[model samples]
Target: MMTDTTQSRGRVEIDDVVIRFKGKQGTVTALERTSHVLEPGTFTSLIGPSGCGKSTLMNAIAGFVTPAEGALRLDGKPITGPSPEVGVIFQQYALFPWFTALNNVRFGLKQFGLSKREEIDRARAALDEVGLAAHADKYPQQLSGGMKQRVAIARTFAVEPKVLLMDEPFGALDAQTRLVMHDLLLGIWRKHKATVLFVTHDVDEALLLSDHVQVMSQAPGRLIRHYHLTQERPRALSRSGNELLEIRDEILGLLHPKTMLADTL
Candidate 1:
């Protein structure tokens, strides 16, 4: 249940953002003049082929990479560096092997200036939210891949960030675990109403979870298309309806025009 205050907090504005990297040869462009707005509390997914700079663009938003050309703003403030208002979940679980699940989550809360008792309480609550309270004492090696990712997610969300940047957070999970995670994530997002920018290479995953799906071009990536999904939530991956299939085909065509053309012929 999102209140008015939380609903109005996480609007993200990307203004003419360009990213580049320096190499031995010269400077290589990663993202080219990309601009878009992620409305408050909405779920947006970035999808493109490999080497399209999907992760690069997301890193800029996370304040891990600085844009060469433009600025990224959140709630009307410029993003100069990582802030507690923005939380990131990476493809790797990224949990500290030495720490137990409870401590891993508590470690993130320590930076927020909470008392030790408060940190413990929040960490416990976060683990409970991710259904890992029973395994709070378990180390990273003791947990499954999905459980480890859940710990990472719990740590991020424990900070109560206004925006969430997830870079293929479920990529390492098994198919069944991924499906379960999708549902769990949606539930948490609905409860907290944080604006989300998810990066994924899987078209179905993008379509299933996103309120808006953004497709980028290969290499020096540029946003080529934006598709708004009006379908109801708790969506299945079955693509059972004509509308879902049509959107899927259109996105597949964009990713592989030659294959789509051959199939049509």
Candidate 2:
């Protein structure tokens, strides 16, 4: 698996990249001259103040946005557009409300026009992987926040994507639900071994789920700090205590100055 970036025995590079958004006022710089490297198979979490353009970076890598400057590549292939090779999961879950969980997973398989039976079998297996086979027949509205996210995770895995892009997938959940999702995500990541770049504002959430925490600055967003989590995988919430909180506070210390001031006062 991947490890520390500096000690990255195997390095992955992202050359200069810049992204802009058109606003009523004018074009806004969401990211600028941003560049970083990630080790293969590593889980990296992006954290920063709100409106820091974390999601923008995810969109850029997912090929939803064209960078005005530089490019992104993986395994040496330049990323120019969205491909099944990358799977993106957002805070909204993005599961169609009308489709049952099973149908959603099947929808991904059907993209290649697989037989109905094969699709059913694959969807079932993917749901089972996320411990949600029993809920396969349920629709998104019927499930709780955690279950819907589980279905989202199942759908992403069903496609066997090369990478998973997550934008605060658990930010909307309750504390208890968030912890459960953390365990579920780590289990799935360990099993699937897909490269995951998770974006979150929750410092503890990032520390809990990522192999590395990438702290970005506010607009004109760019990496300000990165921490390699040497902690073992499959680590649990109940299992983590003071040390985890320490890491969380360290990240908080590095958050945007305004956020720090707001938190202090």
The candidate maximizing lDDT is 1
Could you tell me how far off, in angstroms, the CA of residue 11 lies in candidate 1 after the best superposition? Answer: 1.2
lDDT of 2 by residue, 81-187 (tens): 98777899989999999899999998888887888888899999999988899999999999998999999999998998768889999989999988888888888
lDDT of 1 by residue, 163-232 (tens): 9999999988888999899999999999988999999988889888999999988888999999989888
What lDDT score is found at residue 120 in candidate 1?
91
Off by over 4 Å in 2: 1-12, 236-244, 256-265
Indicate the residue-level lDDT of 260 in model 1.
50
Q: Positional deviation of 30 in candidate 2, in angstroms? A: 0.4
How well does model 2 score by local distance difference test? 0.83
- Model 2 worst lDDT window (10 residues): 3-12
Q: State in Å the error of residue 228, model 2.
A: 0.7
| Cα deviation of 79, candidate 1, in Å | 0.7
